[model samples]
Target: MHPVEDHGAPGSGGSRSAAGWLVLLALAGLAAFLLARPILTGPVAGLPAVAQSSSPYTVHRPAGGVRGGGIVNVDTELGYRGTLAAGTGIILDRDGLVLTNNHVIQGATALKATDTRTGRTFPAHVVGYDRSNDVAVIRLSGAKGAGLRPAAFGDSGKVSEGDAVTAKGNAGGKGGAPKIAQGRVTALEQTVIARDDSDGSSERLSGLIETDAAIRPGDSGGPLFNASGEVVGMDTAASAGFKMAKKGKGRGFAIPINRALGIAEQIRQGHGGAKIHIGRTAMLGVQVRPVDAGRTGSGGQSADGGQSGGQGGGQGGGAEVASTLPDTPADRLDVPTGAVITALDGEPVDSPNTLTDLLLRHHPGDRVALTYRMPGGQPVTQQITLASGPPQ
Candidate 1:
């Protein structure tokens, strides 16, 4: 998964359409999805599939430098084949508080944040996340020697269609430098039903700013700046073409900076409790990977109810448990690794995203039933309470 943006299995080359604007988690390189050279084949299951180009983009060289002091490049490790999700963030406070999209940091085992101005990287900690709004905040844990420059805020409400603006981010998940693209705001108050390709989870985001500014995968959570260089929006999703491997052509939407910062403030204040997970996130306490190819259990049926991956042959299938967190729900139930999660709470589990998407549908302490089959065994159903923790 691009972790936060798209939820396709790693290295998947598939595309789905939505409302004339195909939605993807603005992740790069399904084969490399934003960052990390490929070590395997297949889409990033659990992350959504966005458009990708067989060719590298024409790298744009910013004349002066990365303009804003607050703009930070975000890199996340999604725990699969050294895969990563690359995006951008805006510094909200001099205390090192940074604002980004929830998907950008989702499922990250570790986060490395690099400030464009300081030219330095720092380990960051998740402050809080509002998955409903797709916004999140993190703090640069140990960047004392590096100066923190918060980006100047603009009133998104004051923004008008046709206004000229510039977008910036780690386009292509290419490292070291960030790329910039210029265009005009095309619309306002747009709504996109963005979905995770892997788990089939969707969120209806309203009151967004739409632009034709050439935003690309790996540009999610990046900044949309006005001519004054004031921050106005956070780039989120881009439209993908119908063909697999077709590149997105800059039709992108962003969460209004005002709304994003507002939600981020609540997270910092520790409000909304579990409804808005703070610091650590809620989890089901299980680690899983897609079941192997050509492997069949009882009745010669795959956990996904069919062959692993569809006819296109991507990494689509039910997840095989890899491990369980100690003292957590799965552990308490003695959920053994290698068991295939075929269903959860009666819903079919087609991919790892299915498990996560279903889990996100409930709150901490909520109980849900799981249907699984031990390696080479028959299916078994068990109920387990959910648990809360940081992204591992």
Candidate 2:
């Protein structure tokens, strides 16, 4: 979903001023046009551009004979926030059903998919999302030409450490042609926390296939192929650096193709499982801003000389409540604006994203405990049932 950091730009919650909105717009432009495409930006016009550095992998070869008809370049618009996000997808059926990471299409208003083989683009739409599994499905009803080529799937169960593999995607977010990177299966049944450094949202992922392949930004949801050219996994996340690489070679992660296809089948059949959010997001109905830096445990005092509530025993940083949706969980719990959220379910709230990341672990209709305090007051804890959120 990213190069070194996640896609999209970090969003601020505290203020709703016009200038704030403008800043967000600028960030959106930078993310979509600059970062997404890996192109030069302001003050660099007419300058010679440099090529991407080689992957830090060895014992690899070009994926020349690998089939790429099923790979698609995925792009989505974060509607309300005016940002564009990019990733990759694999065609699952002749009718253009696509499988991708949930984060790829989340909060999307407009979706466009580009076929790797034909270079044809199609308007795509979300079918469903499994936030817990970080998987999603989209349909491309209007794809041009003779439809799509479904990828041949292999048994992920057959994968073993040291197995040969190749990865493909729209590396660098360039949608024209998918890039190829080769490596070997380094581990299996891996568990990780896939994080979005931009927005601070993170997902706990498990049962993953780990590889030393060079997965890049815009590669999320792309295919990981075995030596026989069959899809064995779906490229998902990559480590920022290789702990074992003296030169810092990084590793990549993927969802087993078997697991990915199972979820896709359920989504196509309209199965709304307990962990799946169909066409909606699970939300707590509160807007918050990150606590200012250099503040003590009490978040100090508000700039207006008003009390800002105690910081309590939360982590490094915490979120200051800006507002709560009327009739929602936070409002029902009487979580007043300006209160600082210190913890959730006993876990410290280090930042706005930390709260968001933790809340995403639960689904709609789930109940969570929150700890907070009003300005200059002691901490208070309450149990609140989350509600289905509006489409972003």
- How far off is residue 162 in model 2, in Å? 1.6
Off by over 4 Å in 1: 1-67, 80-82, 196-201, 242-249, 273-275, 287-332, 336-392
lDDT of 1 by residue, 177-269 (tens): 668888888777776665444433345666667787877777778889988887778888765531122333436777777777677778777
Local distance difference test, candidate 1: 0.62
What lDDT score is found at residue 64 in candidate 2? 27
Taking all chains together, each candidate's TM-score versus the true structure is 0.64, 0.62
109, model 1: CA deviation in Å? Answer: 0.6
For candidate 2, list the clashing residue pairs, or say none. Answer: 309-375, 317-350
Stretches of model 2 off by over 4 angstroms after superposition: 2-68, 144-146, 196-202, 241-248, 282-286, 289-320, 323-392
Worst window of 10 by summed lDDT in candidate 2: 19-28
User: How many steric clashes between backbone atoms does each model show?
Assistant: 30, 2
